[model samples]
Target: MSEAGPRLGGRRHSDERSSPQRSLGQRKPARTITIDGEHAGRRLDKFLRSQFKGVPAGLLFRLLRQGKLRVNGRKAQQNHRLQEGDVIDVPELHVDTAAAPRPAVPSTLLDQLRGAVLHEDDDLLIIDKPAGAAVHRGTDVSAGVIEALQHLRPELPELELSHRLDRGTSGVLALAKTPSMLRYLHGLLRDRKHEIERHYLAVVAGRWPADMDIVDAPLRREEDGVVVAGDGQSAETRVSVKRRIGNRATVVDVRLVTGRKHQIRVHLSHAGHPIAGDDRYGGRAFNRRVTGLGGPGIYLHAAKLVIPKPDGADLVVTAPMPRRWKALLNSDL
Candidate 1:
């Protein structure tokens, strides 16, 4: 569970939009951030929103137009995709002084999270996130894995999601314990450098061939949350057949080359093998058939993560297959 190659390791919005950027002289001091590989290729506006969670979009646009926010000491456009190593100067804005308190996470959820921990250390916590559970609470979700864990371990106030897995998918999600560790890991993942490897196990609705192991495709996200293959963002996935059921399904191991939203699902479907139980994609028939036969939820699981540590060691983390997978795969296969 532990190895060493190298070990290392917001908010609020105000809606007042009256020339917020013009009052820079009276505003708080600015801060500079160095862009890394993880944030490379993202729009300038989007990156700022991530940094300043509660800032209004209008205010951000004003800042960009007024030349208050600069990249590499030069004025940048709102749609400017950032490059790694670029330095950005950010101007401060008024944030709501009184923020809403987080709601209490159910004790039952906390117990589930406690049992889901696969590995934990001073800098990182790896969890076997359950299927159908969101990693962080959103508008529709009241409490999620992140909220529950924070409540359960009140001492670790800095615990945060270093990456994310889809709600329908389950398995090895990592949480960083410190800011430096978070940045270190994010840089590795974003750049795809330092030998960071991620592997997934999936059950798809067809018999995939071992020879067809490479899926190099670009993905574009639609307004309705659907991903299509075309000229959007470049993405690739390496897929190999692990096991196959008689003329019905195949178990696949997927290595993501580019972490686009719904990348795996879109790529597999494009290859004519939609994941089982994925209704949003093309697995409705397969989902119905499996549900009628008492199958599990979506058949995608983040099984393993191998990350390079600062000390030139490898941090290998693994999660056991979900009970639903074991129960169904064993019986069905």
Candidate 2:
């Protein structure tokens, strides 16, 4: 919906409008899209789906196979990741032209996000991402934090996610307002430089030992859909007990020394103190218990980030602990 693209090389009458509710199976005029910073690294299918909302995935793949989708004037595949300045050609297909009919983002959430802005300059935007929201659309999520921001700020066409936080995790989500900033930040993260450090707050099951802080484990993804330690890529995390909540749980601060897939969740689980409400790592019983106490999903937050800038001053951003976590922390349980 929302007029997926600005018509290129086409003359339109002042009063004519394409049907608002056209079926995806019907034919329409072809259109071209020039990739920009926001869409640079997105997959072909995912990008197309975002543009032509309501189109089925299977049909999208079929269109790709039929050469209905082209990149830079050549046929492309669904998995093709778009690059900056690349041109995409989309064939005619029945598509909705109205704004997406999805539910509007809650005003409370929007207000929270608006108030959560930690830092913003010409190059970057940092927000305290709320829990239970994806950074971008994926699997079952149709619109995510970034999409919501795009809707709220239509003028920021170059806004791009610098890094990602899990859908269930909260706090300190960084976005790039320019491609160069995105690349620079990514480089710092990739090189594991001390210029940028990420810290998280996690509530875990059991009373964590005060001195048992480091978890160095190599992680590997197995064919069975599990990430196991001792036989994979190198990974490390620095853990410290922040608060002990009786014997039921402990609030801990985690420093991701080497980021990997589900690194914090898997390492903490392997260390025998899985983060509460982490369904994939923490058992279902633990999740039920935590939720039973009115805590939301996984109690992990990207609480703080420290970045060194060219002028020598550090850009430090911190997000307040969620109220539920605070309640749990101060509770007897």
Best by lDDT: 1
Model 2, position 272: C-alpha lDDT score: 90
lDDT of 2 by residue, 1-333 (tens): 133444321311111124344445545756656775545776788667655655666777888898877888888988898887787776667544353365355565566676778898877789999899888876687678887787676556556798889889999999876555676787878876554888999999998889998998889986654476567999989999988888889999999988787999999999999999898889777778788775768999999998876567789999999877766676666
| Top candidate when judged by TM-score against the true structure | 1
lDDT of 2 at 118: 88
Question: CA shift at 87, candidate 1, in angstroms?
Answer: 21
- Per-residue accuracy of model 1 over 1-333 as CA lDDT, tens digit each: 112121212211111112234444435445667765545676788667755645667788898899988888998899998887788877677554344356668777787788888888877889999888898898988889988987887666557899999998999999987655787888988886564688999988878977999888878888876566566798889999888766788889999877889989888998999998887786667888766664757889999999888889999999887777765575463
Question: Model 2, poorest ten-residue lDDT window?
Answer: 8-17
TM-score of 2: 0.70
Candidate RMSDs in order: 8.8, 6.8
lDDT of 2 at 301: 92
Error at 212, model 2, angstroms: 1.6
lDDT of each: 0.78, 0.77
TM-score of 1: 0.71
